[model samples]
Target: MDWIEANFTDQAGLAALLLAALGPDGDDGSHDRSHLLRVWQNATSIAGREADCDRAVLTAAVILHDCVAVEKDSPLRSQASRLAASRARAILAGLGWEAPRIDAAAHAIEAHSFSAGIAAETLEARILQDADRLDAIGAIGIARCFYVAGRMGSGLYDPADPPAGRRDLDDRRFALDHFGAKLFRVAGNFQTEAGQALADARTRTMRRFVQALLDEIEGKSE
Candidate 1:
């Protein structure tokens, strides 16, 4: 919370973005606030090691990237980032931001999505992409994965085919399948060296978790 002012140059602009993205009051008591804080921290840490970046723009992108939350099971899931981007553009414009910086923030917000498949062209965009994906692995990622799965009414895993040994993966139906479907392969796409190192470490944690989960599923763990 204190880092909000410490990390970026323009406290007022950053605060406006937060209000626009997170609502006027901020963090209506959900995991959204925690997730935003983690991504912001990740972005700043990566930016600190890098040569050049617009901290204010990066902060705006981080806050508003998920401004439009589409449920994981929604048919419009793939468009979530694009929708957020469109909204971000308008929000930045309303805040009287210049054209170029607004575009930069909007692009970073949109390109950060895994399903969007848009390459991150700018340093800020790459950092944002890496930072956001960093949150999708490791221990916190495991917790969120199962939490969303439960919300979606998915089982832990198919008991008879825990690893999808016989059938293909269906993350929508089984929580563990999500690890293989996306989380396991996330590290290879990290854009920055710093992000890559953290991603690799987190990925190892996820793999160990999957193994442990499989062991429990088979009653192989003591």
Candidate 2:
């Protein structure tokens, strides 16, 4: 079965806006279809533990969270979520969704962005933010770190000081620097209790990986 069929039991409610939800297909793997799928999976697991979540609202928010494409270094990066939220409202309105539900989805989409620096007011908004942050840590997060680095033409790490001891942390130049720049700090940003727990564990995994990667870079065994 395809991902939607396997991960989600029923999608009858979302079928109408499914295409619009996918947004403009982008070449950025970090924010691609698989990313949306993973976020949905994360949101589902978290939502099951949280109280009174609206599945359709959460699903719509998850799918369209990244509708507006913005690069990591783009001048418009901080506004990406707002742009996507605006677009999401329009898309759902076209689907003839009620005002309240569309507003819920829009809030979730906008607040999900770390760059936006906005608080997630509702349960779905908090869940979406946490769910998206979940994908930015752990084993998968490690892979994406280097993947994005390669795309940005940044090195894996500083050759002389892998820990970035002397010089300032420059993630734009070194992928490893990102752990300090953002990854290590995201655990505390999780909103829901379940999401915070999962984030703590994933952040631990990332810590271990970072130490090991540094050890390998320094040619230290064990």
Candidate 3:
């Protein structure tokens, strides 16, 4: 089977084009161009290590994965991936991409979302899933959690139940509960070995932060 990398397409140009189309007009400090670039970087790294994965498909998927961003808690969040997939197909077609490549990229985009509940059937889809999910963990992910929390008017922690032991989990009200709710579960779902390795390391960093925060609240810090 022939891989798309053999065609020597101009990925950098496609990346710039996609970013221009997806990037915000103003600096909102949300998941913008930088986020797409990081996911692209992560996808490329994962693709480099995997066999029979279509680099072109992964690149296109990564660039256009978040083209249609919905709020995390929005009811339409699960549909974001499917909508992005449709948009990506049109974008790739306009850029002269062939049908096979466009379809592969679209499938990858459709399968990358956690809320969408789509299993990755292709290697490109798997890598894209891992790369996107990777952005939701680690130090940057922690910062992003707090960023969303702040934006949504959520407190840093629940004063009465800091560790959330006695209360039901509510990430919407307490930013720290996000770790237990979603971020900690991400590392286990990575598809590629490279992604898993990165996710594991990032998860460890997150765990340490959570522990440190707990200890600080308990006055156990040295």
In terms of lDDT, model 2 sits at 0.87
TM-score of each: 0.89, 0.91, 0.92
Error of 3 at 157 (Å): 1.2
Worst 10 residues of 1 by lDDT: 22-31
Q: Residue 75 CA error for candidate 1 (Å)?
A: 1.4
Q: Candidate 2's residue-wise lDDT over 1-222, tens digit each?
A: 533335456654464356545646699999987898888889989999976988888989998898888988899999999999999898878866779989999999999998799999999999999999999998889989999999999998889888988989999999999999889988777899999999999999999999998888888999
- lDDT score for candidate 3 against the true structure: 0.85
Lowest-sum lDDT 10-residue window in model 3: 1-10
Candidate 1, 1-222: lDDT as tens digits: 334445445644584556555574333222476787888889988999987888878988898888887888889989999999999888878766778988999999989999989999999999999999999888888988998888889999998899999999999899999998988888788999999999999998998989888988788946
Highest lDDT, which number? 2
Candidate 3 residue pairs in backbone clash: none
lDDT at position 213, candidate 3: 89
- Write down the lDDT of every candidate, Cα atoms only: 0.84, 0.87, 0.85
lDDT of 3 by residue, 1-222 (tens): 333344547577657766776646434345777788888888888888987976667778998987776877788988999998998888878877889889899999999999899989999999999998888899888888999898788999999999899998899999999999889987788888899999999999999999998999989956
lDDT for 166 in candidate 3 is: 99
